[model samples]
Structures are given as C-alpha cells and as structure tokens.
Target: MALIAFRRRSPLPPAEAWRRVTDWPRHSAHVPLTRLSTEPPGPTRTGTVVLARTGRGRLGFDDPMEVVRWEPPGPDGTGRCRLVKRGGVVVGWAEIEVRPDGAGSVVSWREEARVRLLPRLFDPPTAWAGRRIFGRVVDTLLAAPPRSAGGPGRPDGPGRGARRRGT
Candidate 1:
C-alpha cells in the first residue's frame, strides 16, 4: 500500500470539527465530488460510508466506495479511517486523524491506493496522486470554517475531551 499524509490547522474549535466529521451525510456540503452516506449496515462509528465520485473519463463512471473506520479524536483521543474498492477488487485505503494544537487543532491524513489493473510498476504514480488528492481535501477543510457548536442561541466553548492528534 502507498501512504500519503497532509496536515493543516483549522480556525474552528475542536467541537465544531468533531461534529462535522462524524456527521458524514452533511459532508458533501463542504467537500466537492464527495457524496458521503451515513446510514448503512452496522453502527455509525465503524459503519460503512458510501461515496459516489465521478473521476476522469478513463475511470468510466462515478467511483463507488465502501468506507469504514471513522473517528474524531477527543481531548485525549486517537483516530483513523480507511477505504477499499476498485471495479471488482479492493485497492484503496486512508487513515485520518486529528489532535489538539496550542489554541486550535491539527489534522493529519494518510492514504494509500493499489490498483490491480495497473502493473506494480505504476506504484509511484499512484502514491503521487494520493498525496495531491489528500492535500487538496485537507486544504479545503482548512479554508471552510465550521459552524458554532452547542445550538441556536446558545454557543458552546470547548468540550472536555479536546486533545492533540498531530505531531
């Protein structure tokens, strides 16, 4: 598997980012080409997150995904996520995590892709693309600030479990 990671700090508080990441259904609102479905077989934590993404013309159509392992690190928490599926085979994976910074927080994402159709000789290209895609996603999240936590009329400060997930 090829590994790629990107780190970025968000302006929003930990609570805001936690809520946004756990609520997968609403993710498409912030992320482009990413349609995440929260409801699926099994518990939401380890449950499957289906994504329909249309890639290049060569990819043929919207790429279907079977996602699992989702988490938002707490004040003292650690987390990771991964994915797999390519045509009739499984060849994709990702591990994302977040940790508390001094005032805000930092997110680190590691991803890997292995396509069977392509010979092993193309592993370098796959790794390069993974880095680019993961970088863009992290950048987008940093640019879009999160909504205030708590609820309407009543804003919340930080929660009890806000911890650091980056180096």
Candidate 2:
C-alpha cells in the first residue's frame, strides 16, 4: 500500500476552499487523461459514487470511489470527507480536510492506495507519484475561480458562444 499525504494553504476562506476541492468533476481539469463523473449526478453527499475513467478509450481503467463521509465546513470552519475506492484495478481510501487558518484556510489530502498486481517494492515510487499528481490537482483547484452554476465553458452564457465561434 502507498500512503500519500499533503497540505496546501490558500488565501480563500475555509468555505470557499472546501467548495473548490470538493467539486469532483473539476478534478478532471487537473488530472491528465482522466475524466470524473458522479452517480445520481448532483451535489455530492455520503454514498455518492465518483468514478474516474483514466487512459484512452478502450485502454482505460475505472477508479470508482464511494463517499462514505461528507462534512461541509460548519460554524467553526472545519470540514472533512472520506471516500473508499471500490475498483478492480485499485483499492484504498482517501480523506480530505479543510481547516480555518486566520483569514484563509488549509486543505489536507490523505490517501492509502494499492494497485492490484503491483509489488511492494513500488510503494515508494507510487507514493511519490501520488503526491506530485494530487498536490498539483489541489493547488490548481484552489487557484482557479469557482465554477458558476451554469458551469464553465457553457455556450449559453454571455459572450461564451461568440467566443467559441471565434467572432
């Protein structure tokens, strides 16, 4: 098993930081060759299944994770979430925590992942890759603007369609 953990501090408040990190689909923007989708598509909560399909068309594998715990920031500005990976290729659990820090916030991500058929000797490399990839994901998520309700890159929004048409 590979254990991965990292923390990032952001200028955004705890609530906003939580929102950015918890928006599952946005994760695809940062993870290469991966697209994320949620079952019962809507707001995520306990029992929501997040499926990440990685690699090209037929050459891919699905990493499905079911949210077992969901806690949004409360009055004290602390939130936590946990997900269990339920997939044939990979298995483990992940946790995300957000805590208030002065006027900003701190986000921590922890995961215990194991890829099937892989030997224990690869644990160090696996953990290193996980940290690099997930660290970038979290950093990018926090830096980007929050997606509007209409969603990013929607043609219906003002000037969006025109921009797409290159007019």
Candidate 3:
C-alpha cells in the first residue's frame, strides 16, 4: 500500500476553493486519459458513487469510489470530504480538507491505496506518481481564470490551444 499527502495554498476563498476542488467533472479536464462519472447525479453528499475510468476502451480499468463523508464549508470556513475506493484493482481511501487562511485558503489531500497484484516494492513509486498527478490537479483547479477577454489564452484558462502567431 502507498500513502500520499499533498497540500497547497490558494488565493481563492475557502468556499470557492472547496467548490473548485469538489467539482468532480472538472477533474477529468486536469487528468490525462481519465474520465469521472458520478452516480445518483446531483449535489455530492454521503453515499454518492464516483467511478473513474482510466485508459482507452478495453484497455482501461474502473476505480469505483463512494463518498463516505461529505461536509461542505460552513460559517467557520472549514470542510472535509472522504471517499473510499471500492474497486477490485484499487482499494483504499482518500480525504480532502479545505480550511480558511488569512485572505486565502489551504487545501490538503491524503490518500492510502493498495493496488492489486502489485508488489510492495512499487509502493514508493505509486506514492510519488500520486503526489505528482494530484498536485497538478490541485494547481489547475486553483488557477484563476483570465480576468478579462483581452487577457492571454482561453477564458477557460491557459492550456494547449491554437496560437495566432505575430498577432
């Protein structure tokens, strides 16, 4: 099993940061070759099922997860969420916490995972990769969109897209 923890500070408010981080669909845009689908679709609360499908058709696997705990930010500006991985290929749990800081917010993610058929020797690499991937996801989710239409890049934010040379 591999245990991973990542933490980052965002300039956005706690509520805003929580919303962005918990927006499951937005995760697919940040992660490569993966798609997230939520069942009992709607507000995410306890018991919501999230399935993350990775890789291409026939070559992919599903990481089924269920929201075991869901607590959105309140007046005090602190929130927490926990998901339990229930898939055959992956089994573990992940927790996300958002806390308000001075003029911003801090987000923390912790995950413990065990991959079936994988030797313990691979755990370190797994943890490293998990941190790398999840770190990018956090950065992407926290990045502020262009302030105006004239700002560089897409309104959705900077990413791979058409470039008009010599404009």
* Number of the top TM-score candidate: 2
How many clashing residue pairs, candidate 1? 9
Runs in model 3 lying further than 4 Å from the true structure: 146-155, 159-167
Q: Kindly list the per-residue Cα lDDT of model 1 for residues 43-114, writing each as its tens digit.
A: 456557555454434653344455566665655744455555543433676666666666666666666666
If scored against the real structure, what TM-score would every candidate get?
Answer: 0.63, 0.88, 0.87
Considering TM-score, where higher is better, how would the candidates rank from best to worst? 2, 3, 1
Candidate 3, pairs of clashing residues = none
Please give the lDDT score for candidate 1: 0.53
Q: After superposing candidate 1 on the true structure, give the runs of residues whose Cα lies further than 4 Å from its correct spot.
A: 20-43, 55-68, 77-79, 84-90, 147-167
Instruction: Rank the models by lDDT, top first.
Output: 2, 3, 1
Clash number for every model? 9, 0, 0
Error of 3 at 119 (Å): 1.0
Kindly provide the TM-score of model 2 when superposed on the true structure, using C-alpha atoms: 0.88
